[model samples]
Target: MIALHALQYSRATRILWLLADLGQPCTRIDYDRTDAFRAPEELSKVHPLGKSPVIEDNGEMIAESATILRYLVAKFDDDSHTPPRGTVDYWRHEALFDYVEASFAEVALRAIMPAFRGKPVPDDAKAALDIHLNYIAHALGDGPLLFGDTVTLADIQISYIIALLERVGLLAEHPTVAAYWAVLQEQPGYISATRTAGPMVPTA
Candidate 1:
């Protein structure tokens, strides 16, 4: 069985969402953050970085949301969540999965976090966010998901980031992103994870 060290209002929500969508049963171990919004010391015992979304499976532990998602899809997903290996869509899946973190996720995190903490968002930071926002909107295009109606790992990763943008009031400017956010919000798995992750994350 997979065990998730889930942190409320953190990236772990998406990991839970992914698990729910994939129909995989997992033991979710919840953690509370310090008033300062830092992980508790118990988390550090799970991994060196002490981050949420760590998964323990088959006597091995994995950290990082992207890494865990990749591992799960490769090891546990069926054709519904991922295409067969060696096809174009499969490679696209690989690219988008990595791109979510390597590109937008990193930039977006630095952008709205100060605002999330009630600090003013800097002009340069907003500018950087705008660039990625445009890129994300274009990627989302007309469809609600990454590959039309298909819900792949790319959709899971990007949709969670889109949800973050919504929470922080960043989605209004990007209509395409806003539409995609609306679509993901209706998903059963997303709804389940949202409710489960609610108490741990910020209401803001």
Candidate 2:
């Protein structure tokens, strides 16, 4: 069994969804953000970074959304959500999984920071977001998921950034991207996670 340390409105929700999708059981410890919208100091006791989605399994601790996702898939996925290893599609899966945080999520966070601060998004930030959105749209061309109609771990990895874009209204103009998120929200695992973790975006 995995012990999940989850935080509100954080990438932890995606971890929970992944576990639910895999039908894996976990002992979840939920955390709430402070009035400043930061993780409470209590979380530091669980991990040095105090970030959510940290997992304690078999006496080993794991953190970072992408790292945790990879660990979970490799351990519990039973190949249901990942392609067979060493195939072209498998490499694509690995690349897209890393790309979400390294590229798209970074740009999405830049664009979202201004909105979260109650300021207008800068032209450059919007432009950068548009470039990434176009890339993602092309990557997902005419498919419900990144690879095809079936959802994969890469889609789960990318969900946080998509939720952020939707929260800041960046997805309004990109119908394809917007629709992709809609489909993700309809997943049963997503529904189960949100019922406990709330929405991907924080109300505050």
20-138 per-residue lDDT for model 1 (tens digits):
88888789998888888888999989988888889999999999888898788778745676666899978877787788888888788886688787787788888899998887677
For every model in order, what is the number of clashing pairs?
1, 0
RMSD after CA superposition, every candidate: 1.9, 1.3
Candidate 1: regions farther than 4 A off: 199-201
Error of 2 at 87 (Å): 2.3
> Candidate 1 has what TM-score?
0.90
Off by over 4 Å in 2: none
The sequence of per-residue lDDT tens digits that candidate 2 reaches over residues 150-192 is 7788898899889887887889989999999999999888899
Q: How accurate locally, in lDDT, is each candidate?
A: 0.79, 0.87
TM-score (C-alpha) between model 2 and the true structure? 0.95
Question: By how many angstroms RMSD does model 1 differ from the true structure?
Answer: 1.9
- The local distance difference test score of model 2 is 0.87
- The ten-residue window of minimal lDDT in model 1 covers 195-204
